[model samples]
Each structure stands twice: as structure tokens, then as C-alpha cells.
Target chain A: MSAEVELQNVSIAFGNFYAAKNVNVKIGAGEFFSFLGPSGCGKTTLLRAVSGFLEPSQGKVLIDGQDMSGIGPNKRPTSLIFQNLALFPLMSVADNIAFSLEVRGHDKVQRRKRADELLDLVALNGQGDKKVHELSGGQKQRVAIARALAVEPKVLLLDEPLSALDLKLRQKMRTELRAIQQRVGITFIYITHDQGEALTMSDRVGVMNDGELEQVGSCYDVYEAPCTPFVATFVGENNAFYGKVEKVEGVKVKVQTGGSSFIGQAGLGLDKKNYKFKAGDEVIMFVRPEAISLKGNSKKTQNSFSAEVKTIEFEGNLKNIFLRSAEDVDIRFSVPSSSDTSGMEPSKNVSLSFSQDNAVVLPTGALALD
Target chain B: MNSFYKKNGPVIATFFLVAIIFWLVFLIVIPQLYMLDLSFRPNLPPLLRGGPDDVYTLTHYKHFLYGSETSKDAYNYVDIGVFLDTIITAVLVTIINLCFCYPIAFYIAKLATPNTARLLVLALVIPFWINELLRSFAIRILFAGEGVINNILLELGLISTAVNFIALDIALYTGLTYAYILLMIFPLYNALETLDTNQLEAAKDLGSSTVRTHWRIVIPHAKAGIASGSTMVFMLTAGALATPVVLSSPNTYWFTQLIYQWFNMNDNWSRGSAYSIILLVVSVTFVLLMMRLFKVTIGEVVR
Candidate 1:
């Protein structure tokens, strides 16, 4: 019921502009893989390529080791859930779910039976007789899932299908989607720009930027050890320090920026390049906001700086403290709501520090902000 | 009504209301009521009007079923046959126009680029700027013997003799179809333009072929437009006089030609009015039947 999907040097170009550039990844059978990137970053284009709506201009797409060139969407063994769901408004829920079966010449009884089965699978039992518009937003989402699964496709490709839902429904659907994927044991290729969705639901995440897959790794690995400045800033919130490397020692590099020095681990460059640190290479040091602390001293932390607290934003579970360094560089760090905040006030002087292992130093190329 | 008066002041609202009333009463209702009245009276001589012979009767309506009692069969087969022929031909023309215009409308609305769509619309509309009479005459000349098409075919050695297109009613059908093509196309285009293109891709991705996709999705969604276009084309074609006269051969006849002859040649306005009233009733019934068949409301079609 599941198949391995592999892209080998695939590039899709519209005239002179490449929508997807030389993307290569092998999604194993039954794997829940996700492509995470911002808008216009080629994630949707890559998903379209896999679904056979788009043909790669350069290389091959293989499903179960079968070359998929010249195969149209109708002949492919994959189902695509569009961003807007694209359910047939003229049809009942049963008919919408059974559309694939109907098109394949199945009789009405078989289609209805299979449609009901799929509805039950999606936890929408007995909703088959209702019109598509009669269902709630979340129910419609489930109907789309049921319709896609009715075909029993080897691969299910979703192009930000949950993006239109409200926050709570989206969260609930994410878990349900993960559970359904495991139950069916089919390959699921999900495309989205939300880092939370990718981090929580996907077994492996591919971070894309400017038509290029910048990083492909597990959620934990991508968050903990990003190889490029784009991935570091794009995958999560990070305080980036523009600096020059002062020295290299073992796996750690010391960088000096804004009259302040920090030591962090060296990171690799883009996919194949082995970026080495030296005494004069310009770099960017990234540290997650949660990794920084206000109380740690120089003896306990490797990098220490004094800054003036600008503002303290109290989110329900945590408080985000905005600060301005002595050199006027803006910094932000988060503290748990349970932590003591007696000394933390607006415009008050505070000392902040983070351990070296929590920060990463990489050669700057393209920042996600740019 | 009150809101309209408030929005546009009393003077403007009253003026608009008066103008609409005048137009409806004088232009539409009055003329139709006069014709209905005349249809029930005998076509007596002018001197006999308001005399003993001037009386309301069903004689004019009965004349349609039995034109002249002097014949042996007395069933008025020619008139009835011509009426049925006109109806069947109009239906054929409607079906042909639908088959031709559906793809063109879909292409313009969905497949063509915006620039190409604008150009195509311009091309379709530009020919309609000319009078329909002239367009019908042009089609008549094109399909006539030794016409442009036959001349080309002769030059290419494709035909040994000239084809009698008018005798076959091909010229008439072509003229009628061309005359009302825009009426069919615009409505279909308006409906198809609102269709989300993702639905097409979704159907294809679900393994539906192009034919099945249209049968199951596109056609069902465009039912209102189809009903509207079909009704307009059928009514116009059935009631048409100029196209049939210009494009018909010696062997062809149209029901409107009979009505025209009764009014002008026989000086029998009563019979003409009766025939026209019947045509209107039948056309309205056909429209209602179509609406019922398509499962659409009048509001949907009008919209």
C-alpha cells in the first residue's frame, strides 16, 4: 500500500526561472516527510512535481523505483489534497468521497459502501448524506481526507491543507493526520510553512529557501544543529550576531562582534561544502532565545554580556525579555513564567549569558530575513 | 420601495417609477393584450366591423388546425407539418449550438490567457455589430450554389458538382446558429468563469478522464447557463423569419413564414395573432420544461 518516492536532481523551470532547483531526496516507504519553507520557497512546486501535476525539467521522479516522466496526475498512484480542499460543492459527502471510485466505473453500491467506510475511518460516520457545504470547517477537512484516502493511493500529498483552519482545529487535525498516516502506513508528503506543524508531525523535515532545500534532517537535529544561517533563522527564533572569527579550537570557534566575544560550535556550510574556521573568516553566531539566561555568571557560562532591559512581554507560560547590549545590539531571551522577575524591569541593567554548546557559528551567506 | 425613495429623493424615485410603468404598460403589456383580443375576433371586412358579422369566435384559432375545409382530408397537414418542422429544427439548432459553444466557452473562460480571452471575445462580438439581416444574407451567399465554399472545393477538385446546401437546410441551420451564438456563449462563459480551476485538477487527480470530468462536474455546474442559453437560442430560432427566408431553398418552409403570409398577404391579422400566441405558449412551455429538466430555478438562470 505504500511506496518509496525519490527525487534525483529534479529541477522544474518556467522559462528562465527555476521554481525548484535540483532537489534530491529519498522518502522511504511509509515515511511521513514534510517540506517546510516560507511562501514562494518552492515547497508547493516540489509537491506538485511528486503528485505528477508538474514535470521536472531536469531530472527524474521515481515512485517505487518507477520513472514517472510523462505520467499525468490521473495515471499516477498518488492523491493530492489541495490547499483549498477543492471538494465538489455539487456533490454529497458520500459522492465527493467516492468520486475516484465513480470515475473508475464502480457501481453505485460499491462506491457508497467504500465512501461510508472512508467516512468512518475519518471519524465522520453517517455524514455521507450531507452536502459538502452543510459540514463544519473541521468536518469538511475530514471529508477531504476521506476523499483522498478512498482511492487507496500509495502516496498522499498535502499542500498546506490545514492552513485555512483555525488554530485549535489545525492542531487537532495535525495529530489526527499523523495517526491516520501511521494507521494506513502509506507515504505522506506534507508541505507547509509553519515550523510548529513540521516539528510536531513530521518524522523528517526538509527546510527550503529560494528553491533550494537548505537542510534535511529530523526535527530535533534541524533545531539543535542547523548547518546554514537560513536554516538557523528560518526553522526557529534565533538571535543572530554578525561577527568575525577570532580563533578556532577543536570543534568550537570564538567570534568577536560589537566589541564582545562569544565561543560556539562551528557548523557546516550548504549541503556538500565543508566550511572550515580560521582566524579571520566573517561568521554569524546563532543562539536560541530560550538558551540565554539572566542569572548565570561568567564561571558557569562561556559567553557573557551586559545589556539594558528594554521591555518584558508576559506571555501566558513564559516572559520574553527584550534587551539592548552595550554596543546597542538588540537581544531577546525567554524566561519561564514561574521564574523570579523581581530584578527584571524596563531600562534596568542586567547580565545575560549562554553556554557555548547552545550556540552555533556558521559562515554567513543568505539570511532568512533577507 | 420606501428605501429606494429615501435613497434617491422623492422626485428621482417617482420619475424612475413612472418611466418603468410607462415602458411596461405601453411597450409590452398593452401590445400583447391587444393582440390577444384581436386573436379571438373574426377578420371581417372593415365595413362589417361592429355589425352583425363582427363577433368574437374561435374561428381564427380553428383555422390553424384546419386551414381550408374545401380539401378532402381537411387536416391542414402543410401548416401542421411546417410548425412541427420548425420546432424540431429549432431544437436541433439549439443542440448543435450547445455542442459547438461549450468547448469554446470553456476554452475562453479557463484555458486561454487573459489577453487571448479578450481577443477572442472581441472577435466573437465584432461580427455581431453588423445587422443580423446582413449576416444572414452573407451566410446565404456563402452556402449558395457556385458560392465561395463550393468554388474552393471545385478548384481543389474535391467535388464533381456543386452541393445544394440550402436544399439540405444546412444553410438555414448555419445561419440561425451563427445568429444567436453570442447569446449562448456569453452565458456559458459567465458560468464557467466562476468555476474554481482547482476542482478540475482535483477530478483529474482522482483518476477521472476528461470526458467523465465534464459529465460529472463541469456540465452539472453549468446547468443554469445551459438552460438559459438553450432557451434563448430555441425561442429565437423558432420565431425567426429573416434567416429562414434568406437561407431557405425553394423546398423549405418555416412556421413564421406562414404567420407573415397570413398577416401581409391574406390581410388576416386575427389568424396571425392566434398563430403567434400559440408559438409564444409553446416556447414558454419548452422553457419551463427545460428548467425542470435541469433542476434549476428561474433565479439561477437569470442570475
Candidate 2:
């Protein structure tokens, strides 16, 4: 069972402070959506609003074209997997999964049968009789999922449920979660601060900052073409250049910083008319670490700069080269470990350049560092 | 034992151990043993000790079950009725205190803000600062014939005549409930405070109603606290003497009062000790029954 959810100008305020301010988005039925943000950025608040735990102060939450203003969480067709999993420690795995059915007046046999089916769905066969504490961390996570799914909710909301696991288990769970979502074909609204989780699992990602949704787009669009300065820096690592626009040419803009001049394409926007760069406007140019390369090695080099090699970090598949520009700005770029590295040494002068399309220039507002 | 010495050093550890042993022997164990011994002997004069008539027997214990042989009834219904009444009243008091305290404890622990909870706890504790005897007397005055409640009811025309609350045993129940209420509240608050609130939210999010959430989750988690609180309240209410004496009318007869009469008024220490032993056995049985009902061990309740 799946239903579309729409938030129309929803804002939740606690006294004067708005935890979620004017959020508006429609999640497609059966689509896996993720809200990505740092802590206290209102991602969880918005999820709560959809699950009917919180009432929006301003607008409406419409689920399947029905207003859910006065409905409590129990009446809403939504289930939440809490951050801590919140499995009933006093219950066996079967009884924990069967709790919703039990509350709906189902007999013990029916509940047990449904619980067994859900356990099989989660691939935890023969685990129904064990106590919650007897299960491992990953098993507990599955039991929580089965419990949420037993209610047959239309939308399943997850509030960083995998945050407590180790790195390896977390990665494994991510793939399993995506597969499970597709199999059930219900709308899943996942809230997390981890960018890797948001990028890898969600069909579309909503980036939030300080109670406002900065941008909502596909993983490729958010990573390759971020509309705002915050999204570019928050989503991934970026090397930024503080400068003023010197020339505006169609979709390409030239920026001049101290001791260097760079040309990059203008930032993308949902509405192109509202986002434009002009001469003398202050802006920041951002480039991903993998974009920069040695000068004269590629055909599309339009901007170039000289810097000294600072340090090289040898990661498993890639080597990260750090450099300091003539103006003392630190820059970093990565090359595959299999590439030649004979002459790159600390304090050696090197020329670095990137193509225009790989870099984006946007009007500086709020950077993730700030 | 060695850890104790290592933690506290030899001299201090030895001092504490000796003190505990001395208190256990002289204060508790010896008195209980003396009562047990006295309960099995015959009630006699001072000069009869070691004489042929002075001997150990079950006469005093038998006296509790049957009155003098000349009595008409087969069993002593008056004393037995009073004993049963005392037990029923104690159970009722425990039930009433639980019903009153569970919601208050939950509100203080989970629903109310920290400041409001602190203020509520302060309010609950301030009244208990007054002596229990004075509080019981205050309750007696409030429920008396010409008391504040009766006067208000009469003035408002809710009743044409004053109700006999004391004769109806309402005043005694109220006084006992008031006296032992804090014992019930604190244990429940301690248990409920440790409950992770995420569990409650998870239950709600899973489409469980509020009442069902408590039935399946909250009350089950608070079993240890309920057992401990109920056992303490029942025992204390059954053993209470002053509150019943202050609040009861002339018609009311309490089991403790019979024990008091046997020991003091009638100078029959042996019969009083037998009744005391019986009450002790019943209280212990009630505690065991509470443990069984809650499915908790004594260790859990103590914790």
C-alpha cells in the first residue's frame, strides 16, 4: 500500500522559533525520499509532521488527498522507525512485531502468523521466538522494520535508524533497506545527516539548512550542479575561491581573485531568470576535488594557476594531492593511485587547472562552514 | 568480604560489620525470637515460672481460634471478623493508593516539564513534613459530624442531615491512605522515570492507542515498582494503630486494637504475641503473593 504525501507551505513553530519553516514538497507514491541535513536542521521535525506526531503551525499535510490536521499518530497511515530502534525489550521478537495487530483486536494465532510472515519478509526466519535483547544489533534493526511494516502503513518514516551501527553494518543495511523499499513499493521518507546514506539510497534528496530547504534534486543533480552555496559545500567536499565577478557571458562567468583569475559556468537554478551573475557582483567559485588536474594534460583547460605541492595522502584507490596557491589559498585534488607520481613532491612547484564546466560560480550567501 | 575490607580498610570495615551484627541480633532477631517463644507458652503469673503449672504450650494460640469453652459459637467470630476486616481494609487501601498515585507518578515523570515536576514534588513533600498523627487527627476533624465538609454540605443543601463518616469507616480508610501514600508514589516515580520515552513514541507511531500502549508497555515495565509499593502499603496499613484509633468511631474494631488490649489492658502478653505472630505470617504471605502476581523476584523489587 502506497500513497502520495504533500506538504503545502507547512511550518512548525515552538513559540517564536520555527523548527520547520514553510516547507513545501510532494513525495511520489512508492518513491524513496530522503531529507539530508545536519543536526537540528528540522529534517526530523518535517518527518514528524508527516507522521502526524506534530501539527504544522501554518499549512496543511495532505496524504492521499486527505487533510491530516487533527489526526493523531495512531490514526495516521504512517509508521516511524525511531533513531534508537525502540524495540520492546520485554517482548519476544514475534510479539514485538505483532503489537500493532494485537492492538487492532486480532487473535493470538492471526498475530503470530502475521508476525512470522513479516519475519520471513525481513529474512530473519525462525527468529520470532527470541527476546529482543537476544538479537544482535542488525537483527534488532530488522525487527524494528518488521514491526513498522506489520501495521501496513502507507508511508514509513525512518529517523536515522541505522546511526548506531558500525560502519560495515551500516553500509550493508543501506543496500538491504533500499531493496526492501522497492519490494514493498511504499513511500519511504528517510531522515538522515549522513550524505553518503542520502546519496546512495534515496531516489531524490532534499538538502536542508537551518530550518529551510535549500534544494531538492536527484543525487546526480545535487552533487554535480548544486544551486546554492550551502548545498555545494554541505553535500560534499569542495575547494572554494573567494572572488568578484569580472565578466558575464551567457552561462559562463569569469571571476578574479587575488593573484589568480578563473572562468567557470554560472550555478544552475530551478528558475534561470532569478539566478544570474553580473560584473562586480561578489561570488564564490567552487570545484570538486577530482576536477582539478595537471595543466596541459586535458583538452578543455580554460583557467590555470600555479601552486606548490604541500602534501600527498595515499588512499586505497586514489592519491590526494594538496597544494598552496600563490595567494596562500589551500587547494586539493585527487588522482588515481595507478597514475604516475614520480615528480610530485612536497614544496615542488606545479601548475593546476580545471575545465569551465566542472566549476560553478554562485552568489555567496551562507556556506556550510559558517 | 575481602573486597569490603579492601574498600574501607580493616578497622572501619570491622567496625561496620560488628555494628551490623549487633543491631541484627539485639534489635530484630532477638525480639522476634522472644515473641515466638512467648507465643507458644501459657499465660501465667510471675511466681508460676519454673513451677509445675508453668509450661510451654499452644493454649494462647488456641485461644485465638476458639474463645472460652462456654461460648455458644464453634469459632470466635468476633475476633475472626475483626481480623478479616483489617485485611480487607488494608487491601482496599493499597488499591486506592495505587489508583491515585500511578497517573500522578506518570505525569510527574514524563508529561510535566522539569520545573512543574519539581514544584509538584515539592508540594507533595511539604504536607508530609507534618507528623502522621497530626495529619490523621486533621482528617478526623474534617470528616467529623460538625466538620468542615459536613458544614459545607449542610449549607449548600446537599444534605439535610450530617453524614456519619466515622461510623461508616470512610474516615479510617482515608487517614490510612493518606499516611502511606508517599511510599507508593516514590517507587512508581523511580520506575517510570527510568523508562525510555522513545518506547512510548514508538508504540504511538505503530498505531497503538494511548491506553493500549500503557497496558502493553508502561504498566508491564513498572511491575517491580508496583509490587514493592503495594507490599509496603499493605503491610503498613494493616499494622497501623494510631490512624485507626484517631479516625474510627466507638463501633469500629481493629485487629491491632485487640492485640493492644490483650497486652496492655488485659495483661495477656502470651495471647498478644500469638496474634502478633499471626499478623506477621499474613503480611509475609501477602508480600510473597505480590511477588508472584508481578512475576518479579525479591531482588527486582528491592532494586
Candidate 1 clashes between residue pairs 3 or more apart in a chain or in different chains: none
Query: Candidate 2 lDDT (Cα, whole model)?
Result: 0.92
- Writing each residue's lDDT as its tens digit, candidate 2 over A1-370 gives 8999999999999999999999989899999999999999999999989988899999999999899999999999999999999999999999999999988999999999999999999999999999999999999999999999999999999999999999999999999999999999999999999999999999999999999988988999889889889999999888889899999889889999887889999998855433588899999899999999999889998889998999999998999999999988889999999989778899999988999989999888788863
Q: What is the C-alpha lDDT profile of model 2 across B11-120, one tens digit per residue?
A: 99999999999999999999999999999888889899668987789887777788667888888888888989899999999999999999999999999999999999
C-alpha lDDT of all candidate models, in order: 0.92, 0.92
Q: What's the true lDDT of residue A358 in model 2? A: 93
Name the docking class for model 1: high
True contacts kept of each: 0.95, 0.87
Best by TM-score: 1
Give the DockQ-based CAPRI class for model 2: medium
Candidate 2 wrongly placed segments (more than 4 Å): A270-274, A308-315, A338-349, B1-3, B9-15, B44-54, B69-72
